[model samples]
Every structure is written in structure tokens, then in C-alpha cells.
Target: MRANVDFEDLHFERRPYDPQVAYAQAKTANSLFSVEATRRWQDHGIVTNTVNPGGVATGLQRNFTTAQKESLDAAEAAGVFTYKSIEQGAATTLVAAVAPEFAHTGGHYLDDGREAYPVPDDASLADHPHGVKRWALERAGALRLWEVSTALLTA
Candidate 1:
């Protein structure tokens, strides 16, 4: 059976590192993984895709302290920022999982129930060509790491 997953929804919001940075890296890894996995598993009838649900005020947001939380909440309430509830947050994943429209073997990012683009950082945009090449190299490195780790455990 085919499965559709969104990596952003699985983010660890409370990590010590910057949340945006972490999410960006995870999103990159996820896109690369989906592309590589589909290529490797297509013969077995497997398909994979990705989604990015902007910001949702689920339990994940509880990681913020009182002051930070208040600021986020105010921004969200003012309509200046878009923050979905937990149920709303799950909508993209649900659509991806069962929607025939997204059956194609590709990746997508969703925000507010529609197809959306990732908000690229200024640095990333400036290094677009270099970023793409680096991402390709990183994917190869990740595959090697996976191989070595698996081999060590299964040897």
C-alpha cells in the first residue's frame, strides 16, 4: 500500500536548538528521503510524499515559556499570523493519506488547507545552486550512515 507523510508534523518543537532551523533541516532531509525511497521502492508498489503544515498551536507549541507562548498566541489571535488548531493541523496529513489528488509520487508543502511553498530564508535563497548541490551530497552521506549503522547492528 502507498503512504503519504508530512515530516514537519513530526517535528520536535521543544528542542534546545532553534525550531525554525531544525524544521528546515528536517524538511530538507524528508524531501530527499522521499525522493530516494520512491526510486528504490517503486518496484514494490510503494509511494511517498511530504507536506509542511505551517504553524499549528497543538501541544507541540507548549514548549514555549509563558512569555513566548503569550506572544505567539497574540500573534495568532490577531490574524497577523496563521496558527491552526490540532485538528486543523492534522488536515494535511489526512488529505495526503487518502486524497487521490495527491497520489502522484512527489512532495508537497501545505499551509491553510492548500498547496504551499516553503518560506526560504534569505541565506538559503542566496545559495540556491550551492544548496541543491550540498543537499545531494548530504543525501549520499545519510545513505552511507544508514548502511553503516544497519550493518553494525545486523552483522
Candidate 2:
């Protein structure tokens, strides 16, 4: 985000403080980080997974103004984003955490209770597609990001 760069080339070390792109980078990093955890913890019978729980209208948006809330409502109405209740939004993670089907399905991203496809969607509140980006599953990038995050945290 600090650096205007290609989507595939997001660098964990170079990630800046730009709220917009930085948020996306952080989301990508979380998915890749989950992949790393799945790799290192699988033999221990540990499972690590990630989920994009879609959009949920809840107290989380308590700060949004009327206009902003309306914007989200409009988007959901237009099928640009899927709005769910707090309980409904937690469904995917709840399944990933306890569902037997995911016991061996580590290192994957889920959308609506299934493996997410790679569908790049418009981000202008125009269209919201539920899919993980290809970069989110990059093992090498995950490892690198793990190192960077560890070093930063430790320092």
C-alpha cells in the first residue's frame, strides 16, 4: 500500500500505511499465513484455515454514517455484496473451526462453506465476488511473510 505496485508483487516488508491497499495486503497476508500454519502444524494434527465471511451488517459498522450505511445497503441490494447477520456471517468460520470435513483441508480459503475460486471482482462497491486471490495461496510468499512478521513482532 505504501508502494503502488502490482497485485501479485505485494511485499510484506514494503507494505506501507495506506488504508485501502494496505487492508487488502493484510487480508492476503492472513490467508497466506494460514497456509504456512497448515504446513507446519499438519503433522501435529492441527488444522489452519482462513475464511472470507462475506459482508455482515453488525455493530462492527457502528461508526458508519447514514450515507455510508446506505451505500452498503445499496451495494447489497445491487448484488455487489452479500450482507448477512452476525450469526449468519460466522457460519463459515464456525464450520472451519469444528466441521469434520475440514480436518484435513488445511491451507485453504473458504467462501460460503466451500473452497473459494479466484474471481477478481470490482472493489468500488459495484460488485463483490467471494473468491480468494491467487497470491493469497502462494506458499513462498507465505513463508516470506511469516519471517517478516516474526521479525517485526520480535523487534
- TM-score for predicted model 2 compared with the true structure: 0.72
lDDT string for model 1 (3-109, tens) is 11223333445444544445456666665566566666767778676665657766665555676678767876877566766787788788777778667654444
Score each candidate by Cα lDDT.
0.53, 0.70
Lowest summed lDDT across 10 adjacent residues in model 2 is found at 1-10
Determine the C-alpha RMSD for candidate 1 after optimal superposition of all C-alphas: 8.3
lDDT of 2 by residue, 12-129 (tens): 4554333345555666777888989988898988878888787776565766667767877897788677777778888989888888888886988887777776544333223335
Best by TM-score: 2
Q: Which portions of model 2 miss their true places by more than 4 Å?
A: 1-22, 59-71, 119-128
